[model samples]
Target: MSTRRYPHSSVSPEEFHKWLSTLICVLNSVYFVLNMITLQKLGLGTMQLAVATFAGFCLYKSSNGFYRPWHSYALLISLTINILLSIAVMDLVAGATYWGLALPFWYYSLFGLRKGFIFSAIIVLSAAMVIFFRTDTQVFMPYRTIFNFTLVYCSIWLVCHIYEVQRQKTSEFLHSLALQDDLTNLKNRHALKADFQAFQHSFESMHMLIIDIDHFKNINDKYGHDIGDSVLIKVADALMQSIHTKEIYRLGGEEFVILFKNINDKEAFRQAEKVRKAVELGIFFSHNEPIKLTVSIGISSLRPEHEFTDFLRAADQKLYQAKREGRNRVCA
Candidate 1:
C-alpha cells in the first residue's frame, strides 16, 4: 500500500483504517479457527469466519488501491455484530465481552468524533443490555457484573473521547500551520493548490489573478525588512477588503494570488482593476510614516486542458507583462 502522509499527521486515515482492519481480520481469523476446531462452536465460529472473510476482502481491495469509505463502515459493523453475537452465545464469561471496551477507541479512530461517539454509545449500551439480561445471577451477580462493566466501559469511553477531542484540535492546528501564511495570516501556496483541486471540477470556468507589489525590493531597500513586512500585511488587508467572493492567497515574498470562478475574461479583468485601485488608493503606515503603494495584477482564464501549475504559469506570464508595460497597470 502507499505510504502517503497527511498534511496534519504521519499516517492518513486510510492507512490507519487499513492497518486496523488488517489486525481485526487476523484476530478474527485465528479465533474462527480456534472456535471451529478446538472449541467445537460451529455457530460462533461461522460468524467469526464471515467477519474475517469480509475484513480480508476489504483489505484485498485496499491493497489493490480500491478503497472506499463504506468499506470501513462495513468492516467495523460486521466486526461489531460478530462480537455481539459471540457475547450473546457464550455469555459474559466467554471473554468476548471485554472486547467491547476497545471498540470505543477503534470507533473514535475510524469514524471521528461525532460518528465515533454514536457508534461507541450504541455498542456500549447494547453490550450492557446483553450482560444485564443474560448473566446467571446465582453464579455471577448480574448487578455487579453490569456495574463493573459499565464503569470500566465509561472510563475508557471518556478517555477515548478526550483523546479524540485533543487529536482533532491538534490536527486542525497543524493543518492551519501547513496551509496558512505566518505573516499575513492568508492562505499559502500549498493551500492554493489544495483549494484548486477541491473546486476545479465544480466551476465551469475559472480565472486566476496574480498580484505583485510594484518595486517591492525598492521598498525594502529604502525602508527596512520590517517595514516591508508591514506593507505586505497591509496589502493583504486591502485585498481582503476589496474582494468579496474570491479567496486571496499569499504566494510567498511580495506576490499574491486570487481565484475567480464563473466569470468571463472582461469581468475578471475588471475585478483585478478594482483590486489594483484599492491598493493604490490605500495608505499604509509603518512606524507612523504613511507609505503609498501600487500593485500590478495579471489575469488569466482557465483553459480546458490546464492544470493548476499551467493556470498559475499563465497568470505569472501576464504579471511579467504587466510589470514590463507599467508598474501599476492590469494585464490579461
Candidate 2:
C-alpha cells in the first residue's frame, strides 16, 4: 500500500520520536507518582498505574540507539494500549477520561498525515462509544456533551492536520534547498557527504567520478554568465539522462560528481567515458550560435581503509590528471 509523505526536517523522524518518547516518559512518571501519592482519589487503579509504568519504560527504551523504521510501530502499539486503558477508566474517573483528547495531536505528530488521521479517528470513535454509555455520570446532558466533545476534538484535529501539512511542505522545501544545487537542480556536496557517511560503514565498495568542464572560465568570459548557467543546466540534463543507477552531484562551480554503487573499476571507467562522450557531443545554443564544450573526468574506487575525504581526494587528484593529459578525456 502507498503511504503519504510528510514534511522533510533537518531533524529526522527518528530523532523526533526519541525526543518525544523521552517527553512522554517524563509525563507518565509524573502521572504515575501523582496517582500513587493521591491514593485512588483521582479514580486511577492499580491496573492503570501498572500500564502507565510499563508504557513509560517502553517509551524510554525505544528512545535509545540508531533509528529503526519499526520503532514507530512499537510507539503506535503503546498508544493504542493507552487509549484502551483510558476508555476502560472513563466510567470510574471523572476528569481522567479526557486523556483521549490528547490522542489526535499525538497520532498526527508521530505518524504524519494519512496514518495519523486513521488512528485519530479510531481513538475518537472509541472514546465516543464509552462516553455514550456513561453519560448519566457526566455533568452535561448526554447529547450536548457528545456534541461539544466531538466538535472541539475535531477542530483540534483539523488544526493539527493543517499545521502538519504545512510543516511537511516546509520540510520538503528546506530539504531540497539543503541538498540540491540551485543552478542545475542536482544533488550538492552536502547530500554527497551525508550519503557517504551513512553508507561508508556497510558498503563494501563504491565508485566516484569527478567531471570538470574544460575551459569553463573561458566559456563564461566569452559568452557571459547567462550562457554559463545554461551550459551547466544542459550538462546536468544530459548526465541525468545518461545515468540510471548512480546519483549525480553538482559539487559547486563547473565540477560535477557521479557516485556509482557496488560497481567495478572497469565498469566505472566505462561509465565515465560514456558521460564524457555524451557531454562532448551534446549541443548548446548561445545567441543563436552553437556552443560546444567537453568535460574531463577522474575516476576512483573505494578502498576499505579510505574515508569519504580520502576517496574524494583520490578522485579529485585523478580529475586534475585528466586535465593535465588533455582537455576532454577520462583519467583513473
Candidate 3:
C-alpha cells in the first residue's frame, strides 16, 4: 500500500517466487530422473516425480500471475515431506539426509521469524528422531550420528534465525524512512495514502482536512528558511497536541493533512476549526522572538467511488477555495 520497494532485493516478491518455483521444479525433475536411472529406487523416484509435478504446477501458476500464499506453503510442505520420507525409507546414509539441513533457510526466507522457527523446529526434531531410531548401529553409532546431525542443523538454524531478525529490523527501518517526514517528524504524503487505503474499505464515512500555512513564503523570505522550518516544526507540534486523532500527516512544505474516520460533516468541520484556532493562538518562536501564524484548512468527505488521488484532489480544491476567499478559515 505504501509503494515502498523492497530495500534488500532487486527482484520483486512475485518474481522471486517464480524463480524459486522454477528452480524447485527443475531440481526435483533432475532428482526424479536420477533416482529412476541410476539409483533404481522405484518408490523414491515416484515420490520425486510427485514433488516435481507439484513444483511445476506452482511454477506454472506463478508464471501466469496466479500465485497465492498457499502455493508457497504447499511447495515447502511437500518438499519437507519428501525429504523426511526419503530419509525414513532409505536410512540416514543412503537417503538424502543432507537436504534436511537447508530447511531452516528456506523456512525463514518464506515464512519469516515465528512460523519459520516452528516449521524448522518440527523438521529438525523429526529428522533427529528418525536418525536416532532408524540409523544402523553397526555402521554408525546412533548417539554420535544424532549428535553430529543436530549440531550442524542447530548451527544452520541459528544463522538463519539471526539473518531473518536483522532483515526484519532493516525492513522496518527502511519503511519508516520512506513514510516519514524528515523535518517535522510527521507522517508524509506516502503514509497518508497508505492509511487512506486501509481506512477506505473499513469505514463508511471518513473526512480529510488539508491545512496550509498562510503566506508561508513570506516567512521564509523575511526571516530565512531556517526560521521558517522552526515555525513549521512548532506548527506540527501544535497540531499533534490539539488533534484528538493521531491521523496527522505533513504533505510536504507548509501543508499538512488530517484524517477522521466514521465522522459526520459537522464534527469534521468542528475539529478542523479547533485545529485552526490552536495554530492561530499558539506561540511559535524563532530565536526566542515570538511569531504569529495561521493555517487555512480545506475539508472533504470520502465518496464511495473515489480513489485516494480523487479524494485528495477534492480536498485540495477546497483548500484553493479557502485560500482565494481568505487565508485563515475552513472551507468545504
Candidate 4:
C-alpha cells in the first residue's frame, strides 16, 4: 500500500478521535430531540420519559467535549443512564425503534466492531425477551411483521459495517500517503523527520548521512526530465539494495537521506562509504541505455547534546564539500 496526498484527509489517530467525537455529538443531538418529543407525545409515561430526556441531555454535554481526554468511565456512566432509561419505555408494540437502533451505533463508535456487535446483540436480545416477548401489544409492522423486523435489523447492521469499512480504508490510505514519496517510491521527508526523532530519543548513538546525486540538473538539462527521474530512481534503488530498506528516504530533488540506528561512528561511516562507492561504480539505465553517474555522500552522527537536524546538517555540509573536492566520493 502507498500513500497519496488529498486535502482534508488526516492520518493521525488524535485527529481521527476529534472527528469521531464531533460526529457523535451531532448525531446524538438531532436524534435525542426528535425522539424525546415523539416519545412524550405517545403517552408511554412521563417519569420514564423525563429520566431518558435528562440522560440524553447529559450525553449531549459530555460527548461534545472533544478536548477532554477520552476516558471510558464518563462515557460508560452516560451509556448506563441511557440504557436504563431505554428499558423504562421498552415494549414490543411501538416503543422506540430509533432508541434501540442508536445503541448499536453508539457501541460501534466507542469499542470497535466485534465488541460493538457483542454488546448490541446482548442489548437487542434483552429488549426482545424482556420487552418484546413479554408485551401483549404488537409493534408496528408491514404485511408480515416478523419478516419486516429481520429486514430492518439486517439493513441497519449492514450500513454500520459499510461505514466502518470505509472509514478504515480511508484512514489506511491516508497513512500510506503521508509516509511515501510519490516520485521515487521511498519515504518522504516528514516520515524521515519522525523516524529521526524516535531514533534520537531511543538511541544514544545514531548515524545520519545525506546523499545527493552529482550534477543532477546537468542530467536533466542534457536528457529530458523523465530520464533524469529514471536516474534518481536508479540511485534510490542502489541505496535500497546496498543498505537496510527501513533507513532510506528520498529527501526532495536529487537528495536522499539514511539514518542507521544503534550503530557507532565507524560502522555508520563505513556503511555510508559502501553505499557511496556502490552508487558511484553502478551504471544507471535510463531509456534502456546505460548512463554513467555518481553520488556524493556526507556522513555525521549525533553528539551527546545536539538536535537531530544539526547532525544531518553536518553531513549535508560535507556533501557539498565533496562536490567542491570532486563529485564521486564520500566525506565524513
lDDT of 3 by residue, 1-332 (tens): 25434524334556666777888889889988988998798898898899899998988998998988798898989899888887877755564789899899888777778988999899988998887777555777778877888899999999999998898888877788889898998899989988888888998899999999999998999889999999999999999999877788999889999999998999999999999999999887778688899999999999999999999999999999999998899998
Compare candidates 3 and 4 on lDDT and give the better one.
3
| Count of clashing pairs, candidate 3 | 0
Off by over 4 Å in 1: 1-10
Model number with the top lDDT: 3
Candidate 4 Cα outliers beyond 4 Å, as residue runs? 1-77, 88-94, 110-126, 129-133, 136-151
73-125: candidate 4 lDDT, tens digit per residue: 24444444454455445544544544555666555555555765676666655
lDDT of 2 by residue, 168-241 (tens): 78877777888888889888898888778776776667989999999999989999999999999999999989
- Model 3: runs farther than 4 Å from truth? 1-13
lDDT of each: 0.86, 0.76, 0.87, 0.66
Output the worst ten-in-a-row residue range by lDDT, candidate 3: 1-10
Residue pairs in clash, model 1: none
Output candidate 1 Cα RMSD: 3.3
Each model's Cα RMSD = 3.3, 4.3, 2.3, 5.6
Better of 2 and 4 by TM-score: 2
TM-score for candidate 2, residues paired by index: 0.80
TM-score of each: 0.93, 0.80, 0.93, 0.73
